[model samples]
Target: MDDSEADDPNRTSPRPAASGGWSRLSASRGFLLLWGAQSVSTLGASSASFVLTLEVFRDTGSAVALAVLTVMSSAGNIYLAPLAGAFADRIGHRRAAILANVVLATASAVMATVSLIGPGRLLGLVYPLVLVSAIAASMLTLTLTASIRRMRQDADLTRINGVTTLLQRAPVIVAPVVGAALYATVAPAYVYVVDGLTSLGCVAALLVVRWDAPPLAGPRRANPFPGARDGLAWILRHRGIREMQIGFAGLNLFNGLGVTATTAYVILLADRRWGSASGLAAYNVSAAVGLVAGAALAG
Candidate 1:
């Protein structure tokens, strides 16, 4: 997804299970299903992103508005961040992951459905519906991510984390190419339908999973929201996480400007070299493949 790793850089950061008995790579049957669900949902996520960005420009023809998608997503992340971490830590990870997946699937479906109906953008419904759904999807996405992060035990941390990131991102690389081709071949509307179908696939994966997920213990239970400071309090205490926040703050600015600039850039460079939607999709896929390979090697 274009928004890949945007919410929490640590979302894919290593988080091997802090405690467990097995030296094996897996946690349980349920967790396995959960992981599979995440991978599939994420596939649709990137595919939708490619098609959606194309749709935005195709409809509005504004690099500026297309760039604003980052701002809209950031707003969602800000609103969700407070509760996201605490919810992951407090509620059973399995529960949080399942509920979040459901929420995201619903949101994805709404956005896709609105696009499919063809309101002509005269009513101005498509943009708002997609934005709202994006907000909800992001919130739930964080919880699901945390659950995946927490499932594996200590020894497998780096490898599992890398695999998860790869799983989350592999689609980002491949789906867009498929999406661009799909767009060239069919109406743009089908992309959203595919997205909706993938979300359901994620639900199916979730259903198949069978983790005996437990809740976080004592000090970790400190709820920091709804006036409870315990959860928010600890994150603030960590210099590293705080720095992560700062880095992302800067990234949003860079990314916002960069997306628009890329539009201009491709336009400028097209005389000598061209990066059409399909071309861009190919580039992204190659880069993500490189990153996935790197992560695998590093681990």
Candidate 2:
């Protein structure tokens, strides 16, 4: 998920019932199921993402197109996040999460079909499908994250948060290796099918989780813009957070460029390294090392 979700006001949802401490949460079927499902989905999505990037670069050989894809995703997320979050709040997180997974699974299946038959390029289907998939993913992330807070009580908040943080970041280490191997061994369309299956697995996990997930209280607003405005207003009133947001904005301005450049660089390095897929795996490991280190330090 993007860091932007953290700052976005519309991502907010109703808090889960205080279920006790970390020990209690550990024993809670709902928390365990959600955590497990999220972990699997994250790893699968990460692998699928690398595969998609590899296919895009291999086909088009254009980092610019990949960059454009990122821009499209950003625009879609920013525009639809409020409505997505609101919809999640309306339906309850469990249902919303399940639906989001179903959406992703369906999208992956469609993309796979397109790739299977399309000539060279994707017959102009890649970007739109990718955009919708991203939007669903953002919604899923928001709801799942909010659900975590609700699942546990305040007593072990710090520890529970740290553990969840690790769970979220650990996939970076494993996914690249797995993705690279899959890319090297399987057809791209088959890899996409695998991605779709992972999402369906997540749906299964969510279904088995029995939780009394209540919808967001108060009258359902016809327009989410007002809530979004209120959220922004609240953030603006906080000097430190507002300043932090500004700093983050500056960082994000160049992040897309950096991501594109890095992806191209890695692919070029992969070509030079002979076994291109394996080389990509190595790069992913190095990058993951940095992420893990950062998470460790933050912890």
Candidate 3:
């Protein structure tokens, strides 16, 4: 491609290149707004998830409850991935993203209400709400990524993805301890309230930010299922994505159980000796430190 075409902002799905770092991305105000919104949402969701874990373990003290909660949170996202992608493609990513935020905000409100009713009394409802929130969150992430791809070059996408991963992991470093402390000092409902309000902040940012939406090839058909099927077929034809998907499938299979089991194990350890919150927070922070180190190295 010539210089003009290479620099064209309207291009979609450009081939990957070695773009310059944060300087290029930061120059775009729209990207900054999206990044900032996502940062706030990530922090809120991270802290809320931590608090939920604490609440469930504190009440049931059963590994099974934690396992069930983790499964519900993940299963919905896995099941909805293709549908969410198709939905984003059908209605412009911005609209889909806004819709996802609305769902997340509403889910947070419902959870807050559930907390007020007491988690034990409303445990059944809580599981479904968590699943809903997870599904919305996955949709929001997919749409935001599609927005990024539409707005920036592939090289810029790489840097932005790195930075975004850092933003997402940054919360894991502190949210656990902060959430646990808040839960112990205040009430669990407050954590949910904070998360809900932060999500509103993200929605506000999304509303004001402006970007060019990529045009669809044609009008979406009445049924999205076929489009979703085509997308899956496309992925299957790509060796890299196919392999990556297989790897992720295996990773999730093991990682999911290990993660939930570790939480239960740590809580049990804390219960046997030290304070529960501190121990759980320490373990979380420690793991997050490794993640931060890895991110820094990758950057």
List the global CA lDDT of all models: 0.61, 0.76, 0.77
Error of 3 at 215 (Å): 6.9
- Ranked by lDDT, top first: 3, 2, 1
For each of the candidates, the C-alpha root-mean-square deviation to the true structure, in angstroms, is: 8.6, 7.3, 6.5
lDDT per residue (tens digit) for residues 86-124 in model 2 = 888898777888999999999889978876774138726
Q: TM-score for model 1?
A: 0.68
Task: Compose the digit string of candidate 3's lDDT tens values, residues 35-69.
Answer: 78788788888889888888888778778888888
**Model 1, which residues run further than 4 Å from truth?**
1-30, 87-92, 117-124, 127-131, 148-150, 214-251, 264-276, 286-299
| Higher-ranked by TM-score: 1 or 2 | 2
Clash totals in order: 5, 1, 0
In Å, residue 165's CA in model 3 sits off its true spot by 2.5
Candidate 2 global TM-score: 0.81
Query: How does model 2 fare in lDDT?
Result: 0.76
In angstroms, give how far residue 45 of model 1 lies from its true place.
1.2
Candidate 2: C-alpha RMSD after superposition: 7.3
Best by lDDT: 3
Q: Which residue pairs does candidate 2 place in steric collision?
A: 16-150
What range of 10 consecutive residues in model 3 has the weakest lDDT sum? 9-18
